[model samples]
Target: MELFAALERDDYEELLFCQDKASGLKAIIAIHDTTLGPALGGTRMWTYASEEEAIIDALRLAKGMTYKNAVSGLNLGGGKTVIIGDPKKDKNEAMFRAFGRYIQGLNGRYITAEDVGTTEEDMNIIYEETDYVTGTSPSYGSSGNPSPATAYGVYQGMKAAAKAAFGTDSLEGRTVAVQGVGNVAFSLCKHLYEEGAQLIVTDINKEAVRRTVETYGAKAVDPADIISVDCDIYAPCALGATINDDSLPLIKAKVIAGAANNQLKEPRHGDALHGLGIVYAPDYVINAGGVINIADELNGYNKERAYKQVAKIYDSITRVLEISRTSGLPSYAAADHLAQERISMLKNSRSTFLRDGHHTLSRRQLRG
Candidate 1:
């Protein structure tokens, strides 16, 4: 890959390549932007097809963090680290410790958390080497599991999307079709159920489906039938790209809100949704509760503060919808605009402040 060109294209701030032969640690840390504050993102471990693939993934995920944090109103920038190895077989204390040292070298320009193929235990290992890490064990004052907080945020975002679609944000008596009854989705379903929303749930795991059905009195359906099911809202909590071409046409839901990442197969798909007048809560913005929860660790891990920030996702989604309505842009595009506007405002503010400071200093020197 043309590494410099790739970074330059996105105005990326920094990328670090760390290797430790002794522990077989091959990692790439990408810091996309730090205009907001220090970059904060997770450390993902994946067995990649090639080194180039790993680098590309790290860069992509890092830039995504920048947008996520910006839209979520977090005073942080975006960064990510990809460790190229088999998480199951290649993980060792030394490898994580070495990675932690590298993060420490950045002096908190980057903070690492647990991500795909990584666990809280791995985060604990990293904490041994530096304070620039989150998702550590609860014993370390880290927020334990992020699923419940994430679920609550999604529920709140869903209401915001519903308000944009329907006349009101109330989910009472509304039919909500939920795809994937996982940890986060289960909690989301509980919120929906308590609000008197009827649930139609589907999952590949029969046990999970049975559990949701029993717990929430939700009706179960085949996974293939989920997108086409008659419902007012479709909540995708499983995989990404469920909003692709095939599923888009089958969806009857007026509001699309979920905890999935990259719901739209592509950028154009988001435009398609806009054309259809479907209110979509952009995935990154709505699903940021997990990041918000972990980020609380930076300020000493106060649950109340973290959840309060997560609840703002409702306002964030509402802002995205308002921007779309006023600007005639797609919800996804509006989300991008929101993040860009925040970052640009800060950048411009700092530039003007510095320029004025220079002038004031020159005038003072002349008087002296």
Candidate 2:
């Protein structure tokens, strides 16, 4: 399980790994390419089943980031970090600082922000050890939590997806079923309500569901029932890979758009959605708002610039639609094609392209 060989299989030239003794911290960083710009992505903390799973996740996620940045029209290329452990039981101040020290060692080959199982407070701890972190506490005058921005971007992108699917950009008179009521989903619900869209929401947290019911009058159902609910748009604000085989047959929505990562069970799932006539917003593209906002903060926190950049999601989505319609390719493939083209352009210009499609990755595989 050599990551560099896996990277080489995909034509990625730069991959780096780091570990920390202070907390038994294990981290992997895969930079698909810096030809576009510095690699920027989030840091994910999860109790992976194995080191091989972590390595596979990091490699795939980093590659996704490249395509995500390219399609989002950002100058940054994609990269990702995964900390292998149960964040709940494995996290501590020393652990974060030790991890931050690893990030500092990168010297900028990779830049990180918060991801699943990591929070703004955790990022602040990392910040205490390194300048390479973003999405810190608001007291630091940074953007703090990114859920609002993420949801806003997803909302905007969802509207565009709705337009492509239903022939109108207005969310008015639309019924959307969302599969999570976390911070991002909360904001997304507000966006839908503001746009005259009715909401059907679900979550494991009773308090979150009850509060949403009390405030927005959203219909609450069990998490399992949310997907099968009949609706215009299905928004997934939870974790990735929710739209796999089991849920695919149950989905009653015309458009599949969500802020969750890794929404597809597999690449072929995108084709299945297309076959079902579902207007799918590729997860990496629609959900990139958080990364986009944090990437802007990388140079300096620029609220206006960040918002302006997020608006491009509309065009990015439009391009996805165009590719899907004209070439009959799945939305995911279209987005990947766009990113691959950009990498090719960069590689030709600088004479430094990593392998693109299934060559090999050249890093040591981690085992949990």
- Clashes (backbone N, CA, C under 3 Å), per candidate, total 0, 28
- Kindly list the per-residue Cα lDDT of model 1 for residues 8-77, writing each as its tens digit: 9999999899999999999999999999989999888989999998998899889889999998888999
Candidate 2 segments exceeding 4 Å error: 2-4, 14-17, 352-368
**Candidate 2: worst-modelled 10 consecutive residues by lDDT:** 359-368
TM-score of every candidate = 0.89, 0.91
Error of 1 at 359 (Å): 12
In model 1, where do residues sit more than 4 Å from their true spots? 47-50, 86-90, 203-207, 358-368
The TM-score leader among the candidates is 2
Residue pairs in steric clash, candidate 1?
Answer: none
C-alpha positional error of residue 222 in candidate 1 after TM-score superposition, expressed in Å:
4.3
Model 2: per-residue Cα lDDT over 1-368, one tens digit each: 87667979987756666777867788887787776777888889898899898888988888888888887777887888888888878888888898888788878667888888899989999999888888998788688888888888898889889989988889988989988889888988988888788999999889998888888879988888998998999998887789888988998899988888889979888889999999999988898888888877866788888877777787788888889999999999998898889877876755433344334232223321
Model 2, 111: alpha-carbon shift in Å?
Answer: 0.6
TM-score of 1: 0.89
lDDT of each: 0.92, 0.85
